[model samples]
Target: MGESSETSSAPETETFLHENQRSFDVSNDAVTHDNKKSGKPAGDSDDDLTPDDILLQLGGCGLFQILLALIIQSMKTVICWGIGGNSFFAYVPKWRCTDVDDVMNISSTVSPLTTMAINVTDTTNTTAYWNQQCQLPNGTHCSNFEFESSMHTLVSEFDLVCSQSWVTATITSVQMVGMMVGSFVVGHLADMFGRKKPFVLSMAIICLSTIICYFSVHWIMFATARFFFGIGASFFMSIYCILQGEHMLSKWRSTTISFPSWALELNLFSLVVFLLHDWEHVTLIMAFLAAIYLLTWFFIPESFRWLVARNKIKEARLVVNQMAKWNKRPVVNFERMVRSVEKSLSGDEDAKYSVIVLFRKRPLLRLTVPLMLSWLTLGVIGYGVGFGVKEFSGNFYLNLFLFALASIPFKLISIYLQVRIGRKFTSIIAYIVCLVGGLVVTLVQYIDTPYRGGLTTGFALMATAGVGAAWGPMQTMTVELYPTVARNTAFGFLSVLARLGAVIGPQFVYLEVLVPGLLYIMIALLSFISIMCIISLPETNHRMLVDRLVDDLDRERKQEKDHMDSH
Candidate 1:
C-alpha cells in the first residue's frame, strides 16, 4: 500500500496518540476522511492515529480475531498439563516400613500410626513397637518400603520417601528454574524474531520432553524431562497471552483468561489422572495432546502489533487488510492509513529496545518493579496451594476437580469487576480476597473441631480461586502497561522472577511439616504486598497501547516538565 523508508529518529522526542473513541460497523466505509469529530484535518493529521484507531475502523472483534483467539487459547489448554500436572506425577501414596510391619506382626492394611499406638503398652514386641515409631526391631533403619496402592507414580517407581523425599520437592524446583529460564530466553526470541517460529518451537519442545518423561527409567531422568517440559509450558503460556492480547480489542481481552480453557483443562487433568493412575500413561497422553498444537504452525499468523513494533509496516498492512476483508469492510484509501501509521513512528527502522531499556526509563521502572513483586507473590501462593492438594484430608481427585471448578465463577466475577471498577482495583480486590482466604486457612489450624480438615481444605480452595481470579486482570495490565517492543521482554522478566516464587512454593509443603499453617501465613503476607503494588500502578482500562519506546520516554519527560512548571 505504501513505499518503505529507512530513516531513523531518536526515541527521546516521539509521542503517541490516544485511540479515537469511535466505533465502526462491518459494512461501514473504511476511509474515515472526515475531520468533524476529531477536529484534525483528514490527511494532514493522519499521523495522530493509533493502532486502536485502526482496529476500530476495521471492526475490532471480527471473524479473524475470533479464530486467532480460539487457536491460541487451544494451545494454552494443551500446556496447562505441564503447569500443574507435577502434583499427580509425584503423588505420594500411603506407605510404611516393610520391616517394621513384618516384625510387629501387624496387618499390612493397618496404617503406621495405628500400628504404633496399638503396641505402645504391650510388654511383648517391645523392640517392634519402638521400631514402628522409629527404626526397625534390630535398631537399624528400614531399608525396604511397602505402598498401599499398586498404581505407578514417581514415588512408587523410585521409592521417593523419608530420606529421598527431598528428591520429589527438588524435581518441582528444577522445573521452575527451567520455566524461569524459558521466560527470558523464549521471550527474547519472540521479541527479536516474529512470534510464529518460537511458538511452534515451544510446542515441539513440550511434545518431546513429555515423551521423554513417559519413557524415563530413573527418577533423575523424569525430573530432567519435567524441567524441559516446564520451559515449553512457560513459552506457550507467555506468548499466547501476548498473541491474544495484541490481536483483540481491550474490551474482549479479559473475557477468556481463565474460563473455558485454562480452568477446564485443570478439571480435565484431574479426571484424566484419576482414571489413568499410571504416571507414564499420564505423561504420554499429555504429550500426545501437546503434539497436536504443532500443526497450528500452518494456521497461525504473527502478531500485527509485533510486526508494527519491529517497523515491518508492509507486513502490518497485509495483516490489516486481511482483517478488514474478513470483517466485510475494505479500506478505501489503505495507502493513506498506512502512511499515517508510518509517519507516526519515531524510531529508526532497524532500532530495537532490549529488556534492559525498561530499567533505564523512570516511568517504566516504576511500573516494572511493582509488577514483578505482584507476579512473584502470585507464584508463591497460586502454586503453593496447588502442590499441597495432596496434603489435605480428602479425596485428591475430588479436591483437585472442585478446586478448579471454583475458579470458573471467580474468573467470571473478576471479568465483571475489572470492567466496572477498572483493572487496578479489580486486581486489588482479588488479592484482598486471597489474603482473607489465607488468613482463614492459617487460623483454622488452631480450631479443635472434628471438621477442621474440611475447613482447611475449603479455605485453601477459596485462596486458590482468588489467586486464579487475579490472573486475568494482572495479565491484562501486563499487556497494556508497556510498549509492544518491550512487552514480551518485560513479561518474560516478570515471569522469571515469578518462577522463583514457584520454586519456593513447592517447598512450602516441606516447611509445613516443621510448622503447620506456615504456607497460608506466607500467602497472606504476600497477598497484602501484591495489593500495595496494584495500588501504586496506574489504571490502564481505556488507554491505547504504546507501540514505541519513545512514546513512553517522551510522555515521562513531559509529565516532569509539567510538574516543574506548576511549582
Candidate 2:
C-alpha cells in the first residue's frame, strides 16, 4: 500500500506504543505480558510488537547492558549531585580577628561579629574610621580573618567569611540558575539530536567545569564555574532517564531507572571515596571519572526508539540485531518488525511537538503538570533531608553514608510494592511515610525526652530514605506515561521544573537556623503536594504504552467501565 493509504488504514483511536512499555507484571521468576487477557490476540503480531516487546525479542534485559547503564548513572549522580554540593569545601573553619592594631583594638580576641573601633585621642593622632573613611562601614571592623591552622577553603581562600559571607549563598543560587538554563537547552537538544549525544556532552561539561571550580582563585570565579557545573548536572537529570534503555523489557524498566541512584545512596563506597581525598582532589577525581565515562560513550548505543521514531529503519534494525547477538539469540526478523514499526510511525512523522503544547493538550496537561509537581516535591524533600547532614547523630561521613544506606531498603521495598501494589499506591504510601517521617523529625527536635537525639536522627533518616525510595516508581511512571513522539520533549520541559525544585528545596534548610522548626514543615508540605499530584495521575504499571498519547488507554478504560456497568 502507498504511504497515504497505509496511514489511513490505522484507526485514530488505536495509538502505537513506540517506547517505554508498561505491560507485563512480574511474578516470582516469570515475567509475562498476557495480551489475550487484555482482549488482544495471543500471537506477537506486527501490531503487537511494542517497543518493550521488540526489546524482549531482541534481548533487552541482558546483564551486560544493565550493569553498564547502572555504572553510567552512578557516576552521573556523583558528579552532578556530589560536586554541586560544594558547601563542604567552601566551609570556613574557626577563625579570629587579627588585623587590628594592638594599641587601638577593643579587646585582643574578637569574634567575626565583633567590630573593631579605635578610641580617638589627641596624643594618639585620632581619626574617625566610620562611614567609609577607613574603608569600613559604620565603625572600623576587622580587616582580615585569621583562620585556624590555615586550612584551605573557598571562604578562606578569597575571604567569604563574616561580612562577605553572602558570597557562598550567591554562588549556590547562581549555580541553580545555571541548572535551570541547562535543562531548557539540553532538553530541546536531546529530543532533536537524540538522547546519547547531549548527555555525553553534559558529562563532559561537568568534568571540565568541576576541575575549573577547584582551581578558582576568587569566589566569583568559583561561583561562575560552579554555575556551569550546575547546568551540566541539571541537563544530566533529564537525559539519564532517557538513557535507561527506555525500550528495556518491562520488568527491567524499574530496575534500570533507580539502579544508579539506589546503589549510590545504599552504600558507603561514595562516602569512602569522598573522605579519602581533599575537596580539590575529589573534584579532579570526579573529572577523571567523567572522562572515563566519555570514553565509554563510543561503546554505548543511541536510543533505538529514537532511531525507529525518526524512521531510520536501517539503523534501528542494526542496533536491535546487535542486541540480539549479545543475548545469544537469533537476530530479529527485521523485515517483519520494520514493516510493523513503519506502519505505526507513518502518520507520526509530521506530528508537531513543543513544550508549550503541553498546556494546550489535556492528555499531556493532566499528567505533565502533576508529574512536574512530583519532581519538584522530590527535589525539595530529597535535598531538604539529604543536606541536613548535621541532624544525624554520628560521624558526618558515616551519617551521610547511612542516609544513603537507608535509601536502599526502602527502594527495594518500593520495587516490590511497584510490582505488587502499583506505582500510584507505592508512591502514595512512600510519600505518606515521607511526610510522617519529616513530622517526627521536626517535633522530636524539641521537648526533652529519653533517646531524643537517636529518635530524631532515625526519623530524619527515614524522611530522606522515603523521598529517595519514592523516586523509582515516579521516574518509570513518567517515561511510560507520555508518548514517544513527545517523550523527550516532555522530559525537557519537566527538566526545567526539576532544577527549579533542586534550587528551591535545599535552600529551605537555611530557614531552619532562623525559624528552628520551619525546615521540616516545608519538607512535609512539598511532600504532601507531591502525593496529591501522584493521586492525579493514571497508573501505567499494567497498561501498555501506545504511540504518543493515552487515546487507546482512555478508550479501553471507558469500555471496561461500561462493561462493568452492564453487570
Candidate 3:
C-alpha cells in the first residue's frame, strides 16, 4: 500500500510541473504577442510600447488635455473683449419708434438739445449732423417715415456711444494687476494644499466671474468681474504648470509645460477672428467650456509622484499598482519598489542641500541673487515680447497666428538641438538671435516706408525662434538650480517678477510706438544678462534632483575648490 501511494504522488508531481510550464509559456507568448502587435520591428520589442502600455501613459495626456482646454477657453474670452474691437451690439438698446419720435419732436421743438442729441447718436451716420431742427432734417427722417433712406445709412455708419481707449486700457490693466497679485497668492495656496483642489476651486471662480462679466452693463462692473476672472486665471496657470511638470516623466516635462503656452497662442488667434462679430457669444462659449471641469472630477487623478514626495507611501503604491494592472503587467512588489524609491531619495539628498534650508541661510545669497536676476530678466523679455507685440502691430490676429505657427518648427528644432548641443550654447545663441531680431525690427520701423508683411513676418519668425529655443531650457534650469523644497517658492517668486514684466510690457507698448523697439532692445539686453548669470551656475543636464541641504552645500564647496585648483 505504501509503494502504491508513492507512485501516485509521483504522477501528481509530474502533472503539476507540466501545468506550471504551460502557464509560463502562455505568459511569455502574451508578452511576445503584445510586442508584435505594437507594430514595432522584431528586435525592438523591448523598447516598443504595447496598447496597454500606451493606456497607462494616458494619465498625463488626460491632465494636459483638460488644462489645455481651460487655457484655450480663457484665451478666447480675454483676447476677444480685452483687445480693441467693436463695442458689443448687446449694449445697444432696441430703438422703439415711440422713443425715437418723442426725442425727435423734443429736439426739433427745442434747438440746443437738437445738436447734442444728434451728436450723441451713431457717429457712423453721415446724416447724424445736428441741424437747426432735429425733426427729420430735410433728407434725414426716422426709420418709420416714408422718406427715411438716410436713416438706414445713419444707423449703419454711426457710433452712437463708445468707450474711450483709456477706459479700455484701464480695464485691461486692472485685470493684469489682479493676475500679478493672484499668481503669488494662488501659488502659495497650491503648495500648502494640493494641486487638484486649487485647480477645481479656481475653475469654479472662473466660471462664476465669467458669467458676471457677461451680464455686466457698466465699466465698473465689467472691470470688477475681470479682476476676479484674472484671479481665477492666475490660480489655474500656476497650478497647471506645477501639476503638469510633476505628472510627466523627466524627459517629457518641459515639452508638456511649453505646450500650454502654445495652446494659448493658438486660441488667441482663433478668438480674435471670432470676436470681430460678437463678444457676448464668445463669453457664453467660454463659460460652457469652463463647465467641463466638473467632468474632470471623475477622470483626473492626483499626482502620484507628489504623493510619494509627501510621504503618502501606501497611496503611491496603490497608484503604481493600478498603473501596472492597467498596462497588463505583473504586479510590482510594493515593499521592494518602496525600498528602491527611498534609496534613490537618499542618493538625491547626498547630491544637494535642502532647498528649504537654503532659503533661511544667508550664505546662499550668492546663489539666490543670480537666480532672481535671471528669472526677472526672463520674465521681462519673455512675457514682454509675448504680450506687447499685439499692441504694437496692426492685424494682430493674423500676426499672432503666423507667430504661433512659426514657433512649432522652432520648438521641434530647438528640442533636438538642446539634447545634442547642450543647454548653455543653445540658450546663448537664442539670446543673440532675439537681440538681432529686435534691432532689425526697430530699424525696419524707422525706415521711410514699412513693408508691413515682410518686416512683421521676419521679426516675428526671429523672435519666436529665439523664445522657443530658450524658454524650455530656461524652465528646466530654474527647477534644477534650486533645491527641491525651495523649488516652488523660487519659481513662485520668479513668476511674480515675470508678471511685473508682463504688466510693464503692455504699458510700454501703449506708451508710444517708437518705444516698442527700444523696449525690445532693453529686453534683449536683459536676456543677455540672464545668459551671463547661467554661465557661473553648475551644469545639471543628466543629474537627478537633489534633496538634502548639507549635501548640496558640500557639493558646491567641492566644486568651488575644484575650480580654484584648476585655475
Candidate 4:
C-alpha cells in the first residue's frame, strides 16, 4: 500500500518541482540581466548595489528558511510520538485498512509488510494466522474478505482510547506552565549574564531531557521531561530571536528571524514522519542532534550588540573585528569604537529600568497591552494549528510533508506583502482571513457532504498564512519596541502569556472535537481581538530603535495625531 501510494503521488510531486524550477529560472534570469547592465563581475562583494550582492541577500534568506523548517519539523515529531503506547491507537484509525484481520491477511502475501506493521500486536496477530493455516506447498494463502466487524472495532477502540481531548488540553496547559516559568528565569539570566550563556545552557538541558525521556519508566517521568523540555525550548527560541536581531543589519533583520521559524516548522514535520514508525530510535537521534548544537558555542560568537549595551566594550570590538575580517572589510579601530559606544551607553541616559518599572509606568501600559494580546493570540492559534496537523485524515507522513511544503509559499508571499504593503496592513489581513477560516471549519463539522475537502483545504491555507504572518513580525516587533536593557525581560513576560495561550488553544481544539465547533468559535473570537490590537500598534518600518519608554509613548501620540489629521 505504501509503495502504491508513493507511485500515485509521483505525478503531483513532479508537477510541484516543475513549478519551483520555473520560478528559480525566472529569478536567475533577472539577476543575470541586472549584473550585465551594471558591468560588475559575478560574485563580487565590493559594490553593495551589485546583482551578486542581491543574490547573497536572497541566499541568506533561503539558508535560514530551510534550516528553520527543518527544526520545526523535528520538534513536531518528538511532541506527537513521545507520548505513551496508547497514543499509537489514536493514529491507527486513520489508516486506510486498520483491521487486525485485514492487516494479517495482507502480511501473509507480502514479506515487506513488516515495515508498515512495526507494532508487536500486529506481528503477533499475523503469526497466529499463519500458524493456523497449514503451510501450502506452493505459497501462502491470501484472504480477500473485508471483515467489516473487525474494522468497526478498530475504529471504535481508536476513538475511545486515544481520543482524550481532555488530556490534550492538560498537556498544552503544562507546556505553557513550563514556558512561563522558563521565560522569566531564562530571560533575566540572559540579560544579567549574556545571550550565549543562556543559549548554551538551554541547549544542554534540552539535550539531557530528551535523552531522559527515552528511558522514562512512567507517565509521570515522561510528563516531567516534557515540562523541562518546554522550558529549554522557550529559552532557545527567545534568545535565538534576540541574537538574530542584534547580529543582523537592520534592513535584513526581519527576514533573517522569519527564515529560522520555517526551518523549525520543517523540523517538526520531518520528525513526525520518522517517529510514526520508530519512536524510540527517533527520540535518541533527536537527543544526539541537540547535543551536537553544543559545537556552535565554539564558532557562533557572542552578540556584539549585547556586549556594547552592557559596557563590555573590549569584547564587543573584538567580535566586530572578527565579523569585519570574515567580510573582507577593513578593520574598525577598537579604541575609537569603544569610546563612541561608551559615550552612547552612559551619556545622560535614564537609569536602567527593572521589569517592575515597566508595569509601574502608566504610559508603558499602552505598549504592554497590545504586545501581550498579540503574543498570546499568535501562540494559541499558530501553535494549535501546527500541533493539530496530524488530525487530518490520511497517511501521516504525506499529510505532514504537505503541511511543511504549504508553508514555503505562505512564507514567500508574506515576505512580499510585508515589504510592499507594510507589516501592519498585511498582518491585519491575515488575522481577518484566520477568523473567516476558523468559522468555515466550524461550519464544516455539521455538513455531511462532499464539500468537506474544500472546507479543510481553505482552513489549512488560511491558518498557514495567519501563522506565517504573525510569528515573524511579532518577534521583530517585540525586540524593537522595548529598550535594550529591559528587552529580554519584556519578551520573557510576553512569552509567559503566549505559552499560556498555546496551552489553552490545543485543549480548545480537543474540546471542539468533543462538543463540536467550540474551539472554532473561540479561535474566531481571539482572531478578532488580535486584529483590533494589531491596528493600534505603531508601524515600525524604517524606524530607528527607541531607547526609552518616553520616546515610544511620544511616537504613539504622533502616529495617532497623524491618523486623525489624514481623516
Cα displacement (angstroms), candidate 1, residue 181, comes to 0.5
TM-score of each: 0.86, 0.82, 0.65, 0.70
Alpha-carbon lDDT, every model: 0.75, 0.65, 0.51, 0.57
Question: 1-567, model 4: which lDDT tens digit per residue?
Answer: 012211123333332222112111112322322355575433232322211122233342243333433443343333332321112222332222234444455446555456455543464345343233222223444322122222222223223232232443454466567777888777777776778888777768778888986786654565577688778877876687776666543345566656534534454635554454544556676687777776667766676656766777668667666665555555544554344344344332334445675576554565688888878887777666655665666655565555556656666666666556656776777678778878888788788978786667558657656766667767777776675566777888888888877777777667655677666676688889988998887665433343323323443445534543343
Q: Model 1, 335-355: lDDT tens per residue?
A: 665664566565544555677
Which regions of candidate 3 fall more than 4 Å away from where they truly are? 1-163, 260-272, 340-368, 386-396, 450-457, 513-516, 547-567
User: What's the CA error at residue 329 for candidate 1, in Å?
Assistant: 3.2
Badly placed stretches (over 4 Å) of model 2 are: 1-10, 15-48, 80-87, 90-92, 100-140, 148-152, 260-277, 350-352, 390-394, 445-456, 549-553, 556-567
Residue-wise lDDT of candidate 3 within 338-443, one digit each (tens)? Answer: 5534543432222222234445554345466666666565555555555554443445555556555666666666566555664456666776777777667667
Q: Give the TM-score of candidate 1.
A: 0.86
Candidate 1: regions farther than 4 A off: 1-49, 101-134, 258-260, 551-567
**Which stretches of model 4 miss by more than 4 angstroms?**
1-169, 260-268, 271-276, 334-336, 345-354, 547-567
Q: List the residue pairs that clash in candidate 1.
A: none
lDDT, model 3? 0.51
Predicted model with the maximum TM-score: 1
Least accurate stretch of 10 residues (summed lDDT) in model 4? 18-27
> Quick one: ranking by TM-score, best first?
1, 2, 4, 3
Please give the ranking of all candidate structures by lDDT, highest first, separated by commas. 1, 2, 4, 3
